[model samples]
Target: MSIVQETPIYRFGDFTLDVTNRELRLGEKRLELNARYFDALALLVREHGRLVAKERFFEEVWADVVVSDSALTQGIKAIRRVLGDDAANPRFIQTVPRHGYRFIAGVSTVARDDTAPLPDGEAAGSPDAASTPATPAAGEAFPSPTRLADRGAAALATALATALAGTLGGAVAGLFGGLLYGFGLAHAPPDPQPGTASILLVLITLSGFLGTMGGFGVGAGIAAAEYAAGGRAAWRIAGAVLGGMLVGGSVKLLGVDAFNLLFGRTPAGITGGMEGAALGLAVGLGAHLGGGFEASPWWRPVAAAAATGAACGVLIVLAGGHLLGGSLDLLARSFAESRLQLDAIGHFFGEVRFGPTTRMVLAAIEGLLFASCVVGALVAARRPRNGLPA
Candidate 1:
């Protein structure tokens, strides 16, 4: 029923992807490829040297459900890194921007039984290619899959911690906001629903996720692009900024359906809506970052997550209207009520209003998060393994 086992993976140029082994080999060395990216490779390699249109890539690879365009773009970037393919100055993969990618290489399929042991016997004929499998000099670094997995695991752990921390932190912040507004120390409510704090809690959590996903997604994109471009500052920075914006904005858009489903209707209260937006952002951001540091030393993911966590905190609070009044406050109340906190809790949250201060919150948080991402990305870009500085 599946081509995975029935159809053999073909080898081309110096690259080899053993579908049966679930491996991508370059000469005697197996390249480190994450599962999802590997899937993309398998797809392209199966039809080696052919043009894989962006639309087909989307329909075949990500046809599961509704999603934004960013995921496909990210996936292509990852594949190119592992394959040493460049979208520009095509060595292997040629990008027809606004269309698709074409893999242009000499494809030579080998009998699985004949070349299973050493990256397809004679597949790596170049002298330099042969050296990759040899023992590394004393302190030399090898980009092995095992090493990559270890790094990815560490990042996963940190991201989990940060996400949890953000959740708890947001809940606490929401609780206090409710208390403050309840003492009649805040603004008045426009309708009957859950409270402002309740709504903020949810949105803040979302914001944290988006911050995590966007921050880390960009960071990883920078890493991959660096791997391809040799860490040219201008190139990597361009990649990170563009990639981050695309992924981050896409994550925000994805929340539409979920919001409608969870709220049983378009959300109606103030505070409630803002909180939801924040939560979506935070969670997505966290996941994206976790993926970015997959090839770093085990500690890098934690560092990344921590960096993103800090950013998430700033964005979550600001993106909503807690620090200043904006549309965030206007919509937050509906979300607060959705949680169905006690009628009074809902009432109090609804009363928490936003106004002129909203712009200030946005400016401060935006500036801070932007600065953090820039610094973090630069650090990541400096370390060469893929496109980073050597």
Candidate 2:
């Protein structure tokens, strides 16, 4: 009689590497990896804590398939990126110069029965069953209730984190905008009745409120998209656009109604659904291009987000979409007795009044600040803390 060996399932950090299923999962999320990359990872994991020489990888992982040294390097790099590990400050993997590599993280193992009873359609000893892949069918992937609950909890946590990041970013952007508008109004030719300090506080408060609303909408959409599609670029962009449009349209409609009811007038050319959608599209595209949620060396995603935001801001201005500054200017113009005036601020942009140049410049600044902060905060939120899952 032959004795069958149980398959080993390795658990390290928050990841589970199931040898039997040939799957790698981080928390409840299944990471997508190439077949060879998966094999390379499996090899490193199987020989955890010990050096895996280059020759051994070629022999075992790339057996009968000739490849260059760069292939191994790229595989390792891809692994690091997926694991969110830094080459300079290695966490899960460590290089042993040109000799070999080691899986430095502590790992635990569990045994899975290979001889377990087959499902109804297949017989255990049949040729078809023997040739069948180990991967679970779509419907059978999450067979346990506990797993579904865990995934739900994880998604909720991620949504909240991204929302918070957006709020923080919006607040920062608002603060900067408030400073510019407040100071400009205070120093206007009319002798500054409200005082710089008072104006600054009011403007800052208003800007912060608007920013918070916008940021939350955008951030929540991103989280939802990521959860639903799992790194698909198109899905993420769609989510962003949907989220931004919903929030922007609702806010604009409400704001206009409120003003019309209170003062029998409404501000025109203010930021609305179209503007929000454009910004959202830009942000989503930037994040996707920058390596989307799981990117390592964190700065790449953040910088990309900022750059895209700046460009979008410029486009919004050129397309006659009003951002916070322009919207505020419109609001001030809507009321004859309104104390708020941004005309004096245009002097900085070489204009006699708050002009297109000033609006465009401020919009760019706002976009850069908002995107960088949101992406940066999200990245920080996703980072593992004290060796624990993020």
Candidate 3:
């Protein structure tokens, strides 16, 4: 006489892990998982609340095949993505640093007899009674104050991280722009000027400062919007625009006041709120169209960002607004004794001065670089903690 084994179904949170059918489901939706990933998830759920060592995975999940540790890491990342779980603050799968993983969520199991007949009004092979959606158990439906506090803390942490990423990205863009402008001015036709090195250093430092400020404003705005609106795209774009305008306008106002107080003159037609808003709009739209940073193959979002930035840059120049490059040119012209000569850059484009054509060309380049850098940094910052592709 042969004894039959009962199939065990694991229920945790809104997910169901079926051992016999080899399926994972969130409510009625069946999540997509490869054969190996499914096995890995099952292993974690089976050993719920207990650490499953690296050697155990090799023995149980990959017994037939020889694979490296990265394979397991990638599999875990995939599972996390599908489950909408964060490795940093895991509600389901917890990483034990180099040791292995443990499933921390509260799990309940029910065994079913495959050979048993289905009850009336229930189809065969349908979800078992225990698997059906029901009131969320305990802390899920009505969270304790501690759970709410934890969520708020996590959100704040995520926002800060995003803002920091944007700041770094902007600083990089500024450094690049400063170098381009500095080199062009340094190599002007008359000869390399004595103060060219100092000018270069000043430009780099000033540009980097401006970039950092702009990036912080935009990043903080987007993060706040995401938190408040729960990731609505429209709200996010609006946040970006508002944030850019606030930072740009404030900076321009303070700059004008400072110059007037010291030099008794103010530079007009410099980059300000209008330019910031336009760039922010481009970024928000490009990010939306790119389907977010987690998109596969990676280039889709980056290309979209570059295209939008270029278009916005051209439009800003045409509309009589200015970006960093054009604004600096305006400042130089406002002061006759200023050593910042951008004429060489114009000469490269067949213009004797920093003409309209040159401004447009430079604007486009600046926009492209700024958008690409910011978006790339954002993606890099938001990747899974395990450093795997989402």
| Most accurate candidate by TM-score | 3
Candidate 1 lDDT, 116-177, residue by residue in tens: 53353445333333332222122113346665565456444433333333334333333433
| N/CA/C clash count, model 3 | 0
| Candidate 2 positional error at 293, Å | 3.1
Write one digit per residue (lDDT tens) for candidate 3, span 122-240: 43223343244322223433457776666667667767777787778777888888887888788766576569889999989988877777777777777777666544567767877
**Which of candidates 1 and 2 reaches a greater lDDT?**
2
RMSD of 2: 12.6
- For model 3, the superposed segments whose C-alpha errors exceed 4 Å read 1-16, 19-138, 188-194, 385-390
Clashes of 2: 0
Q: What TM-score should be assigned to candidate 3?
A: 0.70
| Candidate 1 Cα outliers beyond 4 Å, as residue runs | 1-5, 63-67, 116-176, 179-390
Q: Candidate 1, after superposition: displacement of residue 110 in Å?
A: 2.3
Estimate candidate 2's alpha-carbon lDDT, on a 0 to 1 scale: 0.71
Question: Which residue pairs in candidate 2 have backbone atoms (N, alpha carbon, C) closer than 3 angstroms, thus clashing?
Answer: none
What digit string (tens of lDDT, one per residue) describes model 2 on residues 1-390?
A: 987565566666667788668889887899987666787888787667778888667555544232334457767888899989898999788999978899877655544744233454444223343342233223322336665565567656666776687667666766776776777677766456466787789998987777777777777787787566543567767877787778888889998898889888787888889877876776677676666544556787788988998888999999889888889889888887887778877877788888999899988877777677666766676554211122
Sort the candidates on lDDT, descending order: 3, 2, 1
